[model samples]
Structures are given as C-alpha cells and as structure tokens.
Target: MDALITEAKNGDKEAFVRLIRMNKQSLYKTAWIYLRDEQDIADALQNTILSCYENIQRLREPKYFKTWLMRILINECKDILRQKNHAAELDDFAEGVHCEELNLCEWKQLLLCLDKESRKIVELYYFDEFSVKEISALLEMNSNTVSTKLSRARAKLKKVIRR
Candidate 1:
C-alpha cells in the first residue's frame, strides 16, 4: 500500500486508479450510509478520486494512505449531503417498490434509524469490521469515545429492531 501511495504521489495515475479501485467497495459502503441516492454516491466517489489525485503529493505518510483516502471520501459525502440539503426535492420514482423485490438487507433497513454519526460508527465497526481504535483514528475521535458510541449505537439498534 505504501509503495502504491508512493507511486501515486509521484504522478502515476494508473497506480492511483488501482488504489481507489481496491477500496471502492468500502468507499461505496461508507457513502451509502451518508446518501440515499445512488447518483449522489457516484458523484461523491468521482469527486473523491479527483481530490485524491490532486492532493496525493501532499500526503506525508504513505503508510496512512487508506485512512487518508477514507477521510477524503467522508468529507465528499458530507459535501454532497450539504448540497442536497439546499436543493429542491425530486419525487421518488421508486417510492412504491417493495423491499422484498429489491432484496434489501434487514440490517440496512435497521441502520436507517441511526443518526449519521452513529450510523457511520456502526458501519465502520460492524460491516467493515474495523476495530474501535481504527475507527477512532479514521474519525479523529478518542478510542474511548468511539467505544462508547459503538455501545450506544448497538443498544439503539437492538431497541429499534425489537420494535
């Protein structure tokens, strides 16, 4: 990963693209929690890629590339959310679609009840299988705080699912 980062930093576009491709699933999962619309996720991803390409040289620690990429993606997701907040709402064409037909996962439906921060914490810890310490580093929070939030989020998830 460090080697890839070094290559990307030195203007190797293919290496940069490959790096982004490798983390695409995780990035998309993170974006899904932030966005309900697929188009928004794509937009966020494109913006993230462009930003990373432009700023890869600014990264001082090559070993931390994955975390840095995630940080950029999170920011891009937040930006899309902010923009959507000010945009006029469009009617949902698929509002009547049945979940069963779509094969929507139970966990994804349950996760909708969480607030953004709690949802992010839950996704990172559970779906992505990132440890509490890793989540803290990605989110720039103290490890204790991350652990506490995870506990609270789990409690909230249980309560919601029981309903």
Candidate 2:
C-alpha cells in the first residue's frame, strides 16, 4: 500500500485509482455520516478523489493516505453542506442505505443527536478507530482539542443513552 501511495504521488494514475478503490468503502461510510443524499455523497467523493489526486504530492507520509483522503472528503462534505445551508433530517438519513458495519438504530440516533463536528469526531474515533492524534491531524485540530471533543461527545452520548 505504501508503494502504491508512493507511485500515485509520483504520477502513476493507475496506482492512484487503485488507492482510491482500496479505500472507497471507508470514504463512502464517512461521507454517508455527514451527507444524507446519495447524490451529494457521490459528488463529494468525486471531488475528494480529484482533490486528492491533485494534491497527493504534497502529502509527506504515505502511511497517512487514508486519513488524508478522509480529510479531503470531510472538507468536500462541509462545502456541500455550506452550499445547501441545511442539514437533512434523521428520517432522510434513516431511509437511505446503511453501512453494514454500523446498522444499529441506537447508535445512529446517538450520533444524530450531536452537532456535525462532534458527530464527526465521534465517528472517526470510535468507528474508524483513529487515535486522537491521528484525528487531530486529519481534522486539522489540536490534539488536546480532539481529546476534549471526544470526551464531550462521549458524555453527551452517555447522557442520551441513560435517558
């Protein structure tokens, strides 16, 4: 995978495409958590792919490719959300296809209760299994800030679950 990333960074289009394919499911899952409409998710993924390809050379660490790609996807999702000026309701999201790994209603409801940033932090930390430091780099946040947000999000979820 590191070799593929290095090749992609060095102008190998096929390697880049392979890299994208390898992480497509994770990309879609992250996008789905943020955007409700499938078309919106598709558009964001496409834009992220293009942005990543264009900026791959700037990436210093090949091992961070997944997180870097996720950061781009998150930014693209935020751009779409800003353009739309509204978030889709939980019902809209519930009607859509689910991620096989996280199809639980309780978990979905808990996630939906938090604001976007908090929800993203929670998802990336818990679902994607990214460490706080990794998440901070991916989200361009301070590590302490990521830890604080994770703590707050967990507190919020606990409160909601206890109700």
Candidate 3:
C-alpha cells in the first residue's frame, strides 16, 4: 500500500487505480453512511477519486493515505448532504422501505435508526476499525464524546434488538 501511494504520488496511474480498488468497499460504505441515493454515492466517489488523483502529491505520509482519503470522502458526502438539505428528508418509515430494497446487513439495517452523525461515528468505529481516539480526530470530536456516542449507540442497538 505504501508502494502504491508512493507510485501514485509520482504520477503512476495504474498504482493509483490499484489503491482505489483496494479501498472501494470501504469508500462506498463510508459514503453510504451519509447518502442513501446510489447516484449520490457514485457522485461522491467520483469526486473523491478526482480530488485524490489531483492532490496525491500533497499527501504528507503514505501511512495516512486511508485517513486522508476518508476525510476527503466524508467532506464530499457532507457537501452533497448540505446541497440536498432543501429537499424533504426521508422519514424513518420511508427510509426503512427504501433500505429494505437495498438488502443491507442486519447491522447496517439497524444503523438507519441513527442520525447521520451517530451513524458515521458508529461505522467509523466498527466497520472501519478506527479506535475511539482515531475516530475523534477523524470526526473532529473529543475522545470522550466519541466514546460516549459509541456507548449510546450500542445501547440503542441493544434496545432495538430486544424489540
């Protein structure tokens, strides 16, 4: 991965493609936390790729590639959400029906009950395997806040499961 990042920074397109391919699943899942529309997800991904490609040289460290990529993707998702805020946000019932067709995993299905920010925090912790401290830094929250949210999200999940 470091080699790929180095190669990509040096203008090697194939290496860059390989790097993105390696992280495609993660990128989509991260985007999905903020976006329900497939088109929005695709748009965010396309924009992220373009931005990454253009700024690969600006990346300060190979080890931070995933973190950097995620930050860009998250920002793109936020931009899309902000742009679409004027539109009527889907209610829980509509969201459930819409998500049903997508056939998400049980965990992801439950995630829909969360607000987008909590959803992002939960997904970053569990799905992306980011530590609470890491998640706090990534999301610009305090570590205590991240831990509290994680605990509350878990409690919510537990309650949902009990129903």
Best TM-score among the predictions, by candidate number: 2
Clashing residue pairs in candidate 2 (N, C-alpha, C atoms within 3 angstroms): none
Q: What TM-score fits each model?
A: 0.76, 0.78, 0.76
What lDDT does each candidate get?
A: 0.76, 0.82, 0.79
Point out the higher-scoring one by lDDT: 2 or 3: 2
Worst 10 residues of 3 by lDDT: 88-97
The worst-scoring run of ten residues by lDDT in candidate 1 lies at 88-97
Taking the tens digit of each residue's C-alpha lDDT, what string does model 3 give over 77-118?
889988988532322221222233434466557777877667
Q: In candidate 2, how many clashes are counted?
A: 0
Model with the higher TM-score, candidate 2 or 3:
2
**Ranking of predictions according to lDDT:** 2, 3, 1
Better of 1 and 2 by TM-score: 2
| lDDT (tens digit, per residue) of candidate 1 on 1-163 | 7898899899988999899989888787776656657899899899998998999998989877877888898788878878767532212211222344333355557767776677778767766667887788888899999999889989987798677
Global Cα lDDT for candidate 2: 0.82
The RMSD of every model to the true structure, in order and in angstroms, is 5.4, 3.7, 4.9
